[model samples]
Each structure stands twice: as C-alpha cells, then as structure tokens.
Target: MIQIANRTISLATEPFVIAEMSGNHNNSLERALEIVDAAAETGAHALKIQTYTAETITIRSDRPEFRIEDEGSLWSGRTLFNLYEEACLPWDWHKAIFDRCAEHGMIGFSTPFDDTAVAHLESLNVPCYKIASFEIVDLPLIRLVARTGKPMIMSTGMADIGEIHQAVQTARSNGCGQIILLKCTSSYPAMPGDSNILTIPHLRELFETEVGISDHTMGTGVSVAAVALGATVIEKHFTLDRAAGGVDSKFSLEPDEFKRLVEDSAQAHASLGRIQYGQLANEKTSKLHRRSLYVVEDVEEGTIASSSNIRSIRPGNGLEPAYWDLIIGRKFAKDVKAGYPLSIDHFF
Candidate 1:
C-alpha cells in the first residue's frame, strides 16, 4: 500500500487512476479548471499538470540542436524552444488550478522538468511530483525533485533497465522512498503493440517499488490492460477536445474517452483478485450444468447396465462422468427410469 494525500492506494486491490492534463488546456486557465472538473466527474483519483517555463526547459536559441527535425514526428520542423514555449503552462495558473482541484476534492500534482520547476512546485506544497520520461536520464534533476521528500512518480519511456535502476537509486538516496515507475512509450501517439504491458510487473520486481503506466496510446485499451497487469497507477494525457489544437491534443484523450479509461481501469483492477483456481461463489450455481452420468432409459431390475442405458448428460446431480466405464458393465440393482441420476445405490 502507498499513501498519497493520506489516501491508501492499494495496488493489490485496485489501480490509482490519474488524468494527465498535460498542455491539453491550450493555455486557458478556464479550460484547465474545467478539465479538473471533468476528471473528477469520471471518478479519477488524481489530476496531473506539467510545471515548466520554456526558458527553464529549453534555450531560446534557434540552433539545429534545439530543433525537432524528425520528419515523421508530430511536431516535426519545430524547434524545441518554440515547442516548449507553446506547450508550457504559465506559473500563475497553478494556484487557481490547485484551488479548483481542492474545491472538488481531487489530488492535484505536477511533473517538473528542471530544478527550478521542482522548487516552484514545492512552494505550492504539492502532494507529490512526477518526472517525465524524457527526464529519466537527468540524474541531477531526479535528485533535486527527490530531495523534496514527497512521493515521486517517474515515467520509464525510452529508458533501459540500467537507467531505470540508477534513477530509482538516485531518488531513494535523496530521501524519496515512496516512488512509482510508470512504463511508458515516448512516442507522440504510441501503438498498442509497442506497449509491453508485462513490463508493469517486471518493473515492480526489478525495483521493488510500485509500478504503473504513462499511456500515450490512441485509446483506452493499453491503459485498461495495464491495470490488469498490476499497475498501481495510470496516467494519460487528457483534453477537453482534441480538435482544439494544443501541442499534445492530437495524442491526448477527449473528456468522454478519458471517462471511459477511468471507469475501465478501475474495473480491470477490481477484477484482478487473489489467485483462485477452484469453483468460485458464482460458479457454484452453474455447476449443475456440468456433465454427469445419468440413466438414459427405463430398465428392469437386475438388468445389466450398458452403453444404451446410461449416458453422460447435464444437470449434474449424479455420478461423475469419470465413472462411465466403471458403471457400464454393472448390473442394475433396481428399476431405473429415464432421466434418473446415476448413483452407486442403483448399481449392483
């Protein structure tokens, strides 16, 4: 069990669902508050925001190194500085958004990209901090965020096993013991095939910490599947409308889709009870439908039971089907009617 905001999050029982309002607000404070309300309505346990100014996240230089030049990328041809400029949330909006979350009783947290961003969030007394996948390799930044002594959630996208190990070590060394690693694919719009959901449990074993998923997949399939695989937390970018054209809007989920993700992730987690093999409570009633040995026709007393007289059928109030061969050549002790349940008492 992990405690966040005084609430016990039981990974063994159910997942902690989070709605990532990452640059999905389109720079509107009003929309950010509305997103919080929408997330709360969907029964989400927490709402997340990204904290960083463009100047802090990237340099304003238009150099080739600062530009995203991948042709297949969503934000291709745009410089990192320009991209961050448009995507960055103004620092002033944090208080109103946090206030709105408080009014609605939702946990508001943020992902900090740099040391300065961490300080800003610390001043706000945020319950926890999230480390984006791109920052997983930033050990110094991880140490800075971890020094705050709050619970930390890190996304493991594009990170190898060694890197993840180091990041977890850095946080623990810096006094952040409560940490969760989110299995993520760093692509803009991730594909289901690329999301190795089995990693959720593997990460838990590798680090001995809580594991989750930072889903960027187009739909809720991957997110819901992650819950079934022992994901303690789930974070997905959310927007009021994808058509509104925010930096992450194309890959983010709309309000209705996000609601479904929240509801389905909880359902998936609830369905994963302790390992059970035998007939369950609900299965007991359906046991009668199982096949069992039954008398197929009327027979006179002392008659030899044969294949024609007994058969395996439904309504399982008879000898087990495994006894069919044992009873086939036996003598009938009494007259047996058709549809009668076969039992030892009826055999000689």
Candidate 2:
C-alpha cells in the first residue's frame, strides 16, 4: 500500500479518486482555483495538474510532421508545440493552486513531462508525481522522477505489457518503492469499449503494485466498473464546463459529473462485500419475509397435515421448508388455527 498525504491508498479500501485538472484551466489562474474548489466539492481526495511548459514538452518545430495529422484527433491541424503552449499551466500558478488545495484539504500533485518539470515540482515538495501515458516509454524521465523518492504513478495508455514491465523496472531500479500503475486509454474522449477496465486486476497481479484507472470515457460508468474490478485509484480529467473550449474540456467531467464519479465509485467499492454471505446485517429483519412451513387453515388434533392445511409461506417463524416432506404425512399434536406458525413439536 502507498500512502499519499497521510491517506492509505490500496485495494483493501475504497478507491482514491483524483480529479485531474490538466490543461482544463484554460491558462487562467482564477479558473485553476475554481477547478480546484469544484473538484474538492465533488469529494475527490486529490487534485492533479500538469507541470510542464511547451518548450519542456516539445520543440517549436512547425514541420508538417510536428503537427497532428490525424483528421480524427481533437487537435488535428494544430502543431504539437502550439497545442502544448496553450494547454500548459504557468509555473507561477503552482504555489497558489497547491495552497488552495491544502486549504480545502485535498492532495495536490502533478505529472512532470521532463526533468526540469520534475525539479520544479520537487522544489515545491509535492506529495507525489504522475507520469503521463505518453511518457511511459521515456525511461530516463521515469528514472529521474523515481529518484525523487516520492510515490510515483505511471499511466499505461499505448504501452504493451513488455513496455510496462520495462517502465516498472526502471522506476524500481531508480529507487522508487511506492509505485502505482494506471490502466489508461490514450484516446481523447475514449469510448467505453476501448477502456478495457478488466485489465485493472491483471495489472495488479502482473506488477504486484497498486493499480488504478486514468479514465477519459464520457461518464461515471467506466470509473464505477473499474472500482468493481479492483482498481484502487481513479483519475479523471475535470473541467468546470465541457463546452468552455479548454484543451481537454470535451472529455473532462464537469463538477456534477465528477461528483457522481466520486460517489458511485465509493459505492461500487463498498458493494464488493466479503466472500461469505448468508444475510447481511441490514437484511436481518427482512429475513422473516422468506418462506417457511406454516398452517394455512384450522386443523383439529389428530388431523393429518396436508397441502390444504399446511403451506410454505412468508414471515419465517415456522419450521424450515426443507422438512416439508416429513411434516406432510404427520398428524397435528394440537388444534392448529389458521395463519398459525408451524413448530416441530406440532407434529406427532
């Protein structure tokens, strides 16, 4: 189990939900604070930001290859540099954002895209660092982040099992003992079918570390299902409004939606219950509603119990139905009245 900001995060407890405010701030400090407040109100335990400048993430190249060429992508025609520039949160905003999160009692952390970003976040003494899905293959960067000795969370989006093993090995080799692997789908506005949430338990078995989900799907359905499958943490993009035109706004959950994710994820986790079951504590009183043997009509002494006089009915105060055959041919020991609960001694 990994502890973050004094919170014990593991598969045993309910999922720790982190609301990622990545680039959804729209470059405004005020908006960033609002995002933090809104996420906190959603009962999310943590709020995450991305600490990277465009220059740190990529070069200023304008070549056709430097721009996204896929027509289906959200940033289709935009150059990577320009897109990152617009999406990047300024370094100066980190202090206030982190402070506000502390004031609101939420864990504040971020994903470091480069070595410099890691150093910058380290100076702030951030609780943990997250490695974005795109950077999973960047072994050197992962090593640098791991060397900080803080808990590290790596997202597995486009990575195959072999690549993920290499990343996990790199983090462990570089001195990071507390590591969390998140099952992720790289697509923006990912579809439910592509999420493959069932991989959560498998990831835990494969890596022998905490496993979680960094969801991009439309609703809380994916997040809740992930919890049901043993995901210990859930990270989802958050925005004040999806129609506000931020870089990740389209796929991010608004305040209400994120709140639902937090609530429903916890509920799903609680519903897992223990392996053995007869009746839960809350169902004790309701157990009386179950069917059992009872007298349906009046029968005098020496009367043979028959289908007409005895029946399996509700209000389970009578003999168990499992003894139905034995009681059917027996004679009543007393004058049983209609609607009376049958007892074992009533049979002679």
Candidate 3:
C-alpha cells in the first residue's frame, strides 16, 4: 500500500482518483483555485498540476522537430516551446494551489518536468511526484525525483518495455520505493480502442508494484473499466468548463463528469471483490427462492413416491434437487400436503 498524505492507496482500497488540472486553469489563478474547489467537491482524493516553464521544458527553436506538424494533434502548427509556455502554471502560484488543495482535504502534487522543477516541488514539501509520459525516458529526471524519497507515479505513454524497465530501475536504485506505473496512451483525446487497459495487471505482475491509468479518453467509461482490470489509481484531466477553452480543455472532463468518474470508478473497484464462489452474505437469504425437491402434490402414508407427487420447485425448503432420483421409488413415511416442503422425515 502507498500512503499519499493521510490516505492509503492500494488494491484493497477504492481507486485513488486524481483531478489533473493540467493547463485547465486557463492561465488565471482565480480560475485555478476554482478548479481545486470543484475537484474537492467531486470527492477526488488528490489534485495534480504540472511544474515547468517553457524554458525548463524545451528550447526556443523553429526546427521541424520542435514544431508539432500532425494535423490531428490539438496544438497542431504550434512550436513545442510556445505550447509549453501557454500551458504551464506559474511557479509562484504553486503555494496558493497547494494550500487550497489542503484546505479542501486533497493531496496536492505536481509532475516535475526537469531537475529544477523537482527542487522547487521539494521546497514546497509536496507529498509525492509524478513523471509525465514524455519524460519516462529521462532517467536523469527520474533519478532526481526518486532521490527526494517521495512516492513517484510514472506514465508509460510512448515508452516500450525496455524504457519502462529502465525508469523503474532508476527510481528504485535512487531512493523511491513507492512507485506506481500508469498505463497511458499519449495521444490527446485518446480513443478507447488504443487505451489497452489490460496492461494494468501485467504492469503490476512485471514490476511488483501498483499500476493504474492516466486516462485521456473523452469520458469516464475507460477509467471505470481500468479499475475493474486492477487499476489502483486513476488520473484524468479536469476543468471547470471545457467550453471556456484552455490548453487541454478540449479533452478534459468537466466538474460533473469528473464527479461521475470518481463515483463510477469506485463502484467498478468494489465490484472486483475476489475470486469467489458460493453464496455471499447478501445472497444467502435469496437461496430459498431457488429450485429444490418439493412435495408438489399431496401424498398419504405408504404412498409410492413418483414424479407426479414430488418435483423440483421454488422456495427451497426441501431436499436438494440432487436427491430427486434417489427419492423417486421411495415410499411416503407420513401424509403430506400439496404445498408442503419435502424432507427425509416425510419419505422412507
């Protein structure tokens, strides 16, 4: 089990829901605080923000590689540096955001994109750190965050098995032992078909650590399905109003949608009780409604038992259905009514 703030996150507990306010603040501090309030109201366990500036995340260059050329991308035609600048939360605003989260009883943390961002988050005494999907290959950054000895969550978006293994190894070797690997599809507004949530369980088995999903899908269906497949944490982008338009507003969930995600994901986790069979506590009382051997017709003493006199029926208060063949040729020990339940004392 991993403890974030005062809450324990594990397979034994409800999925830890995180409201990721990544670039959804619309670059307004007031709106950012409002988003925190909305998230807390939705009963989310934690709130996450990104900690990086354009300078810290990328270089100012017009090179083809530095520009997003994919027309399908949300920020198509924008340079990576400019996109980061527009999306980044101001470092000075971190304290207010964290304090607001605490006031609302939520654990506040950030995804650090660079070593300097890690140092800044450490100064704030944040409870944990998240490694964004694109940085899973940045072993140096992983080591830097791990050395802080805080629990770390890494998103495996574009990473292959070798890259994920290296990142996990680096973190453990440094100092962080509480690590969570999130199954992430890097595409913004990602399609459910590409989610591949089945990886959640495989990741846990392979790494011997908790696994979850950083869902970018348009709705909560994917997140809820992830929990059923053994996800212990669920992180989704959140916004107060998508129509207001922020960097990630196109894909982020609104407040009501986020609330549903929290509620539905918990229900999904609860449904995964265990590898169980037989009657449960709630089901025990309903067993009486099941079919069993019953005296369907009246029978007098010394009467021959036959299919016409006894049969499997509902309101189980008779011998089990398995005994039907055995009682077929037996004689009645006593008189029985048409509605009476059959028992050993009524048959010889």
Q: Which segments of candidate 2 are over 4 A away from where they belong?
A: none
lDDT of 3 by residue, 149-254 (tens): 9899999999999999999999999999999999999999999999999999999999988899999999999999999888999999999999999889999999
Candidate 2 per-residue lDDT, tens place, 55-104, comes to 88889998988999998889999999999999999999998999999998
Q: Superpose all Cα atoms of candidate 3 onto the true structure and report the RMSD in Å to 1 decimal.
A: 1.2
TM-score of each model, in listed order: 0.94, 0.97, 0.97
Worst 10 residues of 1 by lDDT: 6-15
The CA-based lDDT of model 3 is what?
Answer: 0.93
CA-lDDT, candidates in order: 0.88, 0.92, 0.93
lDDT score for candidate 1 against the true structure? 0.88
Candidate 3: residue pairs that collide: none
| Per-residue C-alpha lDDT of model 1 across residues 151-247, encoded as one tens digit per residue | 9999999999999999999999999989999999999898899999999999988899988999988989998988878888989888888888898
TM-score of 1: 0.94
